[model samples]
Target: MFQSFTPLNDKVRLCQGCDLPIRVQQELPYGKNAYCPRCGTQLSRGGSPSLSGNLALAITCLLLFIPAFIFPFISIHLLGVTFSATVPEGAWNLMSHGFPLLSLLVLFCSVIAPIVLCAALVVCHLALHKHWFTGMKLGTTIIYRLKPWAMIDVFLVSVAVACFKLKDYSDIIVGPALYALIVLQLLSVLLISRVSLRRYWEAWRPEHTFEHQSKERHCIYCHLSQPVGTHCQRCHQPLHHRKPRSLERTLAYLLAASLAIFPANLIPISILITNGQRLEDTIYSGVISLFNSQMPGIAIIIFVASILVPMAKILGLGYLLVCAHWRKERFQRQRMKIYFVVKVIGKWSMLDLFVISIMLTLVDRGQILDFVPGIGAIAFGLVVFLTLLATESLDSRLLWDNHPNSPTSGRSINER
Candidate 1:
């Protein structure tokens, strides 16, 4: 029911996805969506955040967050013995068993990072509502940085895989923490979706006095517009229209990740030693084993998480780089869409590492059933990390830019 925002500064909006700058369109009174013309990405949903409403969800998220770790996550009964684990216990178990680095990775990505994300959203939303403008900017930047790394969703998937893997051998019982995690993850997703960043940008929108658009350098990370070569006023980061060295860094990471993939696949990732019988698994062989065990659901998930995601990320990034380097302007939306998907789903390849962590904690039966990390697991982890870096560095806007006939070509980017 809100009218179109008309700022006194005549602020120009840049598409975060495709980088095409455009005027804001008024939403249809019927509540139809407003979208970027160049890329058809959603600009707004014809409404703003209900500060109190979302703040309550944020509070609820924080409330549920602890229960997700405090209660038992899963209980396993095998061979007349019972084992159980809580959320924090899993990572600490890893640390106690000689995987200190992995302990940190899991603890940070799964627990601390997500908690900080929820808290940051709370601060940002509260700051916006209270007219605490600078804190809002700072909190928004923190959310953006932590957004990808706060991987509760990935950890949840790992939990599911662990359950599937052990179900055949153990009587798997779901715990209250699992339910709590589900609700917490769901709430976090909803809270993020409910955020209207357009509102925040408008709150921080500058009354630009620059005579020309080229003189307006915008920091892509925080969307702060400023004079060229100076630090951002709000985020204090460097200002640039295009991401710095987007292509060069992407290529470097892509090549390094590709080199690691060979050893990652050729070597065994993990070994299962049960009752003196040894079974080794490469990434593909693990998938095959899952399939052979009649656990096709788990098999498909592992295949997608471990194999398809990395390939999609690497190949999709490679294609984007090639298209950008060649200045191929055809299908700009499709390329940008591919880039968007890669940026999101690519990081989930870390699900494999998460699964490793959970298994290492949950499946140690001492001579009966012990899980050992192989050298290949290390290499595979490198591939996941490197490809994630590559995809993140590959700016999607490059897919739309540098084109001879593109709308952005020969235009003053700083102009309103």
Candidate 2:
């Protein structure tokens, strides 16, 4: 039922390494790699079902999406009076306090984004099941479009920070809903990974069936038939072989984030004083006080999320860039592990921001022990924001794309 298509200048190419004539076979399966028999250089194939897994992930995300929205994310207790707020409640509280901008941000990140992402996933999955490829394509497109909105990781970190900030003023209790929200966020991430579009598309396209008969030349490294001796643009070497920049870009971002972390921690996220005259502290000071107050467990968490995690991310990304540039192949595998950790943990830096928002919304003492955002909070927020951008901007494929034997010049052959 398929038609044979041919390139205008089809030709048989000789492998530079092996000097063997190369044949262009018609209809290679999508994502399958081939190589020269003599030198074992790679070849490229494309086309796969892009929407199937993403559709399933979207559906599952919808199931978890409900509890995340309805549950109370946190509870606050002050002066023996307890108050609770869900994601929406927190936003409203921010708005009521004349911090409309903060409220809107809270609403968007904590509530709206997660919900929309779940909905988009469900739509994409359903389209794929019906064999509506166009619909599936649109769904995948929407999924990418909505990915930035799923900020549950950010929200969760914020919740942790908020809990730390509230410890001194009165008894703080983490609500059931807050735990549920965390679970939902995790599930959402899992769903996104499961439905990776690239994997699916590589499997769905039709295979080619015809073979080219003209004389041609193929790269010695990657076995693609080139017009003659041409270099792979991605690897920037002579056409004979393939393999694979900027430490400066990574370092620039790391330095920027590091500079921002100072203000983020110094900013007065919230102040608590026993009976209005005992103590005042920002997030950093509060963590110290927590340790001093014999609460080492909470102190450790604060130290990790607020201090260690962010620094590790910056340092880790920097290291990955440096190592990759230097071609330190011994620890090459370690780079992948580090990249995964950085991507996963970068959002947690926003925990401080979440805590500040929650504290400002939950605690109000009419100037007795007021909660006002410090300049450091804004700086810290910028640091987290920029760092997340930096992490995303980094191309993880760089870690694996440089193998001398990789096909398509190490450009991802799969288009899913």
Candidate 3:
């Protein structure tokens, strides 16, 4: 059941690339892209979206997620002993082993968030072009907000990497859940992204057009349109054209993460105890060990996730902040592109942390191969968390404010 929200007099949009607010002109034909006149960013490509297709993918993803939870993901056999754990089982094991925080983190990233995200999309797509369910707007808003927190793909990669790491000393078997998890990744992506911008605009139902001076507002959280100072009629969140305290909060987070990266890199992330021989591994030593172990691919993955990503993110955000503060209108589009890349990869940088968590949970059996968490683990995790907050705190709208034509660009984008 779906229902429409309050009617509007203007179709206000915040550019995904530049955040410049403007009215949608006549709907373009399917497959044609409309670029922003101010920043040359492709605003939207016209198309008739298949709500049915999205619904099918969401349903399929839900089916697969069930098996991904039930089937044992990995079996490691050593001597005469065999141990296996499913996704939720692993989280429970982590909790039973006294790491409740990591357990909750694993459960949310792999299970709860993915399920809610897919379920939300199904509801939103079913409610498309008309609202019948009071939860449509709330559900859709949750999908957008939860997408980043769903780490099924990253968790799958971690599981695969864990199996490979265990293969040297133990018999390794990938279970049915891993396969289901893989396919779920593909379909779940469609569930998350298949809904077109055109469908969102149409379903939300703003007025067909309006004067450039109408002073409309767009919700940053839900992307719903409203007039200035009014609550978002759809999602009920207070309206802010851009994130509040955007630049100041972003800079604060950037500085804090910068302080953290040094110790996070310099200290051991986890300690290894094999047959009672103790070894400490800094992040660099771990990557070096992976290379020495002839697992260059895994080593490269760890290096990128642990070393390169954080450094790049720190530098990238600092550069974007400096450019914004300096009002260097040059390369506005390029800056926006950089911002997007940094934001997307911020979560993936947690791959090392996930790997450590998995090993800590699974390998604590009588020192055959035991892994224990280290102090630097906290520092490293903070770096990842802070960078994520920094990215969210940034307001892309600031990028266009200094442009020479930005003042008149809203009206100009209407024609383009």
Best by TM-score: 1
Q: What is the alpha-carbon lDDT for the whole of candidate 1?
A: 0.74
- The digit string of per-residue lDDT tens for model 1 on 1-416 reads 01112342245555666655555443333355666666666655655456567678878989998789888888887678777777777678767767676667778778888888778878877786687877787777777777777787888989999988877767988888999999888888887777654455555553343333432454665554344576765556666667889999999999998898889888998888877889999999999999999999988998998889888888988998999899886887788788778877976888888888777767765838778776787778788878978977877777766644454422323211
> Model 1: runs farther than 4 Å from truth?
1-11, 26-31, 129-134, 204-216, 221-229, 233-236, 365-367, 405-416
List CA RMSD, all candidates. 5.0, 9.4, 5.0
Residue 147, model 2: Cα distance from true site in angstroms: 5.0
Residue 112 shift from truth in candidate 3, angstroms: 1.8
Report, for every candidate in turn, its global Cα lDDT versus the true structure. Answer: 0.74, 0.58, 0.72
User: Which tens-of-lDDT digit does each residue in 1-416 have in candidate 2?
Assistant: 01112343343444333334444454457665556453343333334434545556566666666665676567776766776666676677657756566566667767776777767666655664576666555555566555655688767766765676566666777677766776777777777545544333323332121234332333322234433345532222355322212345666777898787776677665445445574556667878877887878767777777788888988888787777566564554567668768877766665665666677666664634456555555566567666776776565434433434423321222222
In lDDT terms, how accurate is model 3? 0.72
- Residue 223's lDDT within candidate 2 is 32
Off by over 4 Å in 3: 1-16, 21-30, 37-42, 96-98, 125-133, 196-198, 204-216, 221-227, 233-236, 406-416
Selected candidate, larger lDDT, 1 vs 2: 1
Q: What is the Å distance of residue 212 in model 1 from its true position? A: 9.0
Q: After superposition, how far is residue 36 of candidate 3 from its true place, in Å?
A: 2.9
Cand. 1 TM to true fold: 0.86
